[model samples]
Target: MFELLHKKINEIISLTDEEFNYCRTAFTPRKLRKRQYLLQEGDVGKYQAFVEKGLLRSYKIDDKGVEHILQFAPEGWWVADLYSFFTDEPSSFNIEALEDSEVLLINKSSWDMLLQNVPKFERYFRVLLQNNLVATQRRLMGSLSETAEEKYLKYTQTYPDCMQRVPQHMIASYLGITRETLSRIRKQLSEKK
Candidate 1:
């Protein structure tokens, strides 16, 4: 369980075995059943979860009760409401398990402590946030400039594993398109191949 966590951390910075062990002390392993809610709208998010296995999604329901998926976290990814976790404010998004999931959870307090104890962790988190920001910017640019088919192709090429794991309708939601549009796109792609 800690292997992925350790590897991910090492990719950001070299941590001595002792430092890794200290960092490990701050995390708690959690198992979430499929469809379980890790966070609900209006509740403050307390922890950031590192996905060890399975999938989770963060979404918001509009006034019409349609779920708009914001992001998906598969194995080896991290998920959380950063605004809610950092500010202790209620989150507008809900994070739910798409499949039975194993995760390592680090509470805000523990994260702060870890950063103080191991300054290198600050660099790790900084890089993580930078990468997330860059990806988000690219997604926003794509949404503004790309056609539905273009978006669909980009998504599949970038996250082919996610297409296999996530449901079609949810993927459509994330792409800001109707399920019918997604089906058409898939059919078009298949025909072209």
Candidate 2:
């Protein structure tokens, strides 16, 4: 049941079997249907989830009520509103399953205990958060400087799997382009190939 979590954690920090077991004990397993929300704006973020199966996304609704996707979390990924999860703030975004999903959720209390009991987890999370921050920065930079075509290319290169997993319009939204523009880009690329 903990196989994917074990693999993901091991990729960053080597944990003894006992440490792994202890860590697993802190998390509650949850299954979400597609379109079900793990979190929503105005809710105090409660838990960070480690994805074991399927796909999920975090997004925001603008003042105009248009949805803007912020991130996609496939298997082996983690998703949460870090601000809410860390600061007890109400979430500014929503996290929902894009497909039926299974995840391991650790509440703030459990997270604290896990970090204390398994110190290696500190390094594991630091690395994970660091990588996520760097990636977010890179994406922000790309969005400002890159063209629609470049954005699409970079997105496809970075997340080839998402094409099959996420709807095209969501990908377009993430790229900051209109869906019709994305369609044209796809057509141009297909013709060249």
Candidate 3:
């Protein structure tokens, strides 16, 4: 159960077996059914979930009722409303299981405990936050400047397996383009190949 967690953490910082065992104690395992809500808008985010199996997405519905996907947490990824998780405030985003998933969850108390007990995790989390920030910045810039085909191409490169897992409409929503536009872009790209 903790194998993926160990691998992910080790990718950032190496840990002894004893240390890894201690780290795994901070998490609680949970299973979510497809389309089930993990965190809902207006609710305070209680836990940050590490995906052990399957997929989940964090998104927000605008007043116009269109969903804008913020991030997709496939296996080995993490998902949470960071603002709400840190501030103990209501989250504007909703986190849902895109498929039946198994996740390891760490609540604020457990997170604090883990960090306090294992200082190396501070560096690990910092690296993760830094990478997330960089990705967010790049995505923002891409949204403002890149053409639809460029966005789709980048998305495909960044998440090579996502196209097979996610539906076309959700992919369009994530790319900030219309479904028809995505289809056109895909067709054009395929024809060029």
Candidate 4:
């Protein structure tokens, strides 16, 4: 269980065995079955979860009852509602398991302790945040300016694993396209290949 976390952390920063063993104490493990809610809208987001297995997604339901996916967390990814976690506010997003998932969770207090104890993690999280911002900005730009086909192609290029694991309608929601449009795009792309 800690192996994947160790590997992921090592990829970003070096932590000695003694340091890692201490750091792991800050986190608690949780497992959720497919379709289960990890964080619900209106709830205070208490934990930032690191994915050790399976997949999770954070999304919102509009007044029209439409689901707009914000992000997906697969193995080696991190999932949380940053706003709620930091501000003690209610979460606007709902995080749900797309598949049965195992995650290591740390609350704000434990997270702070870990950072203070293992300063290297501050750097690791900084890098993670920077990359997330870049991807978010790019995705927003694409949503505003790119054509449906272009967006679909980019989505596939960006998250090929999600293409395999997520449902078709949810994929359409993520791409900000209609199910019929996604179907058309997929068919066209398939023919081209």
Candidate 5:
């Protein structure tokens, strides 16, 4: 279960075997059922989860009660509301399991302890956050500028696993398009091919 986390950490910063073992000891493994909420709206997010398997999504409900998906984390991905996790503030978004999921969870306290004990972890997390921010920015730009077909293609290319696991409507929400529009776009893309 820690294998993915270990690989992810190594990809960012190489750690000695002892350091990897020490860092791995701080994570708590959990299994979540489908539709289970990890963090709910108005609740402070207590933990950042690293996916061992399955899918999870974070979304916000609009005033009209429609869900606007911010992210979908599949196997080997990390999911968290950074603001809520770091500041203990209520989160505007809710994170939930889209499929039965296995995850390694690190709470704020544990994460702080790990950072203090393993300074290399700080570099790893900083890189992770920087990459996430860049991806978020690119997604925002695409939402404003791209057509539905382009967005769909980009999403599939980036997260083909998520496309397989997530429902079409949820993908539509994430793409900032109506379900009918997504259907039409998909049909058009298929016809083109």
Candidate 6:
């Protein structure tokens, strides 16, 4: 269960066996069934979950009942509402399992303890945050300026696995395009191929 966690950490920063053993204790393992919610709107995001198996998605529903997906956490990825987790405020987003999944969860306190005990972990998390920020910024820019076809193509290129695992409507939501628009784009692209 901890193998993937160790590998993911080592990919960012090397850790001694003893150090990794100690670090592993900070996380709590969880199994979520498909359609189950990991984090719900109005709840405090107490845990940052690392996906070991299956997929999870963080999204927000607008007053019009439209879902705007923020991110997808497939195996080897992580998901959390950063604002709520840090500030102890209610989260605006809901995180749900897209498939039966195994995740390692660390609460804010555990995260702080891990960082304090393993200083290299700070660097690991910092790198993750920096990449997340860049991706968020790029997505925002694309939503503002890119055409629906361009956005769909970019999404497909970036998350090819998600294309198979996620529903078309969810993909459209993530791309900020209508479902019909996504269908048309997919059809056009398929014909070109």
Model 5 agreement with the true structure over 1-193: per-residue lDDT tens digits: 8988888788889999999888888899999999999999999999999999989999999999898998999988999998899899999999999999999999988899999999988898889889988998999899899989899999999888669888899999999989999999989888998
Where model 2 places Cα greater than 4 Å from the true spot, the runs are none
Q: Rate the local accuracy (lDDT) of all candidates.
A: 0.94, 0.93, 0.94, 0.93, 0.91, 0.93
Q: TM-score for candidate 6, please give it.
A: 0.96
Task: In angstroms, give how far residue 143 of model 2 lies from its true place.
Answer: 0.6
> Candidate 3's residue-wise lDDT over 141-191, tens digit each?
999999999999899888989667999888999999989999998899899
Query: Candidate 2 on 11-113: residue-level lDDT in tens?
Result: 9999988998898899999999999999989998899999999999999989988788899999999999989999998999999999999989999999999
TM-score of 3: 0.96
Quote the lDDT for 44 in model 5: 93
lDDT score, residue 121, model 6?
93
Error of 4 at 85 (Å): 0.6
Which 10-residue window of candidate 5 scores lowest in summed lDDT? 158-167
lDDT of 6 by residue, 100-161 (tens): 99999999989999999989998999998998899999999988999999898888998797
Tens digits of per-residue lDDT, candidate 4, 22-100, equal 9899999999999999899999999999999999999999999888999889999999999999999999999999999
* TM-score of every model versus the real structure: 0.97, 0.96, 0.96, 0.96, 0.95, 0.96
lDDT of 4: 0.93
Clashes of each: 0, 0, 0, 0, 0, 0
Summarize candidate 1's per-residue lDDT along 1-193 as a digit string, tens digits: 8999998888889999999999999999999999999999999999999999999999999999888999999988999999999999999999999999999999999999999999999899899999999999999999999999999889989999987899899999999899999999889889999
Stretches of candidate 3 above 4 Å error? none
